[model samples]
Target: MKDLVIVFPGQGSQFAGMGKQWFDGNRVVRDRFGQASDLVGYSLADLCFTAPPAEVTRTRFAQVSLLVLSYAMYEVMTEDRKIPVSAMTGHSLGEITALLAAGALTFEDAVRLVKARGEAMESCVAESGTGMVAAVRMPVADVEKCVEEFNSGGHDVQVANYNAEAQTVLSGTLDDLKGLTAHLEDRGAKVVKLNVAGAFHSSFMADAVPAYTEALHEVEFTEPTVPVYSNVTGEAHESPQSIRESLAVQLTSPVRWSAIVASLVERKAAVWVEVGPKQVLKKMLTGAVGSGEVHSFDEEPERVRAVLDQLVELKKREPGLVGLCLGAAAATRNRNFDTAAYDQGVVLPYRKLQELSKLDQETLSDEQKQTALDLLLTIMRTKQVPEAEQRDRVESILRRTGDAGLRTIAGALAT
Candidate 1:
């Protein structure tokens, strides 16, 4: 099995019919949804499949729905596909889902916890005039400088989510946010407003802290089966008190997503699967892991299965393929396909042919085979090894293959 880090998504990732396909097709998901509905006192299936978008988008409902759907996806990926989860982390509300996946929280307690937390957040939002805005293409230091400058002038804006290398989310009063946007834009940052009910992960959430903390007391946090990163510290937590405290502080703490990804990379996370309703986390991971393997399970079943098959083979043959594919996926997601950095790693080129030699000719589509070939070509072209020796080695490997398509790719690369 691949060393997979299962990353869950947070708000802004939910929608009606988010997990309808899985619910309709999988008995386990249906059963899990039934239990969640019982615990939360509402048919999550109804709200997720047919409720008005507005209702589902409410903080209370949105949080619950995202948790339920992401949990269902986790069940499908782990129980059905039998994918081993190495470590887990989440963005915002997703941290709860990660906790559940890690076995740190029971499903029922998790449901109740998020429901209480969401209601508290919604209450806070209803009583405050606060929101969040994205500062794009700006480094964290610059965003912090902007926040400091604004807060020094008696404004209340603060960093909420450190989403990526170039993205940061600020939460504060609407008027303050509007003013800060201009200041941020002046500093060469592209500011885009987010449609959130309140300024989560800021001091505005202080009022909700006690209620969330009280609710957390009711839940039992067990030892996790896998390493679970805390959004509060971007590190792993094992103690029950530590996990509980982390969850409460997470409300008022900047989601250290960039830091969490860095930590995962440091541990050599072989593959990252964003098990949620959308591709949001997968996109953020690209810039963070830089040519690491990432995949999303929100697509049609065939596509998901195909990707999983490829991942299994990649894991078995060339683990480094995970990083290459991740970088490539990140590049594709960000609309930048240049692989200059990917070509520079010394060991990447050495095993290029060995990795390609295991491709399943019958299982992979033509385009999939070509993609592997293209990566091999890129890895080979770098000055990591002598061209003649690399060519001889690759040709030797190709001659041993029974795959006609792979050989055809070898011929193309030869000329």
Candidate 2:
């Protein structure tokens, strides 16, 4: 509730036994894994929790597995734990997860979409012989410069992911990644070759675009109920079309991660919860914000409960702390906590709403008060609250405004 954002990690976050506890204990978690397995024609639980490292890490398996686990965790957080999120973002494959959580896509559609995406990317990797490498302790600019210099004459290489301020991943032909290592090391950057099939998020993925776009077109999209940032632009998606376009571009574009983190910070997101199988995103986010603010929920009930409890206490102290609970990361948008706001028959304490929304309580005009109430009603409706309930809450809050016409208008809306 404390101006929090939920982030989902990408493919490499997977490991043997990831999400095993949830699969063992939670029916909802197991059910989701089953759903994914049925859709993908393989046991996702086996791949995510029991498979050999090599097999689980395959691009095709890794993508769907991460989505299933991340969404399961998101389900626990929202339905069971009731955590509130303000915004959401995801890394690479994680971006699909983000879109799912934002209401831009459905679960069945996402599963099919990511499956197609992974297969497409895997085919590209297999056919092109492209690879990826991570460069650490180097500014993103320096990493880009190194790629440009190495690519100026012959080979094709580009920055694949702007992961952090001083860490980036590069993608190119396998030989090109090897070729650039020495020059990067000479510049004091630690370069390690990643064990990935193809150069994802690079021009090598161009062939994967059309097919994935077709899958995307088959899915229905709605504007996000809560702000969701885009990995392509590192900003809040302006509309459903923008989200769709960005998802398509993400196939052959570098992930603008560091910029996304900075954007979240600018938007007043203070605490970051990484909902996935591992702490990969939490570690990266810790570097962006101080370590005290990031929590990683992998499948440990105690750890997950501890973070949820912490956020609940936060909400208790600041009842206005808006929490955007993700129903399913990359599938469902903010759900439970937004209800927590309106369930009280008011969005927030008058003074707190003024502070958070930056609207003056002493505003001069009745029309402005009506406008604010209308916007709140619209948001509650977008969250899909029943019409009668939304209007009741809005009318309850509007009663505090001493304007007769405003209360009458609220009554009219309730009808």
Clashing pairs in 1: 291-323, 291-327, 292-326, 292-327
Cα lDDT for residue 55, candidate 1: 88
User: What are the lDDT scores of the predictions, listed in order?
Assistant: 0.76, 0.74
As a TM-score, model 1 comes out at: 0.74
On residues 1-415, what C-alpha lDDT tens digit does candidate 2 reach at each position? 3566788999888777788888888888999999888999999877876779888888888899889889987887777555555678899888789878767788898999999998888877776778889999998888889888988979788888998989899988878888899889988999988877888898889988998999889888776656678889988776778878999989899999999888767655777888888788888878687433777877354766776688766655542211111111112233545566544423343323354345434443665555555545545554556667665454333222213234444454555
Worst 10 residues of 2 by lDDT: 321-330
Candidate 1 regions with alpha-carbon error over 4 angstroms: 300-415
Model 2: per-residue Cα lDDT at residue 281: 88
Root-mean-square deviation per candidate: 13.5, 11.3
Candidate 2's TM-score = 0.76
Q: Cα deviation of 168 in candidate 1 (Å)?
A: 0.5
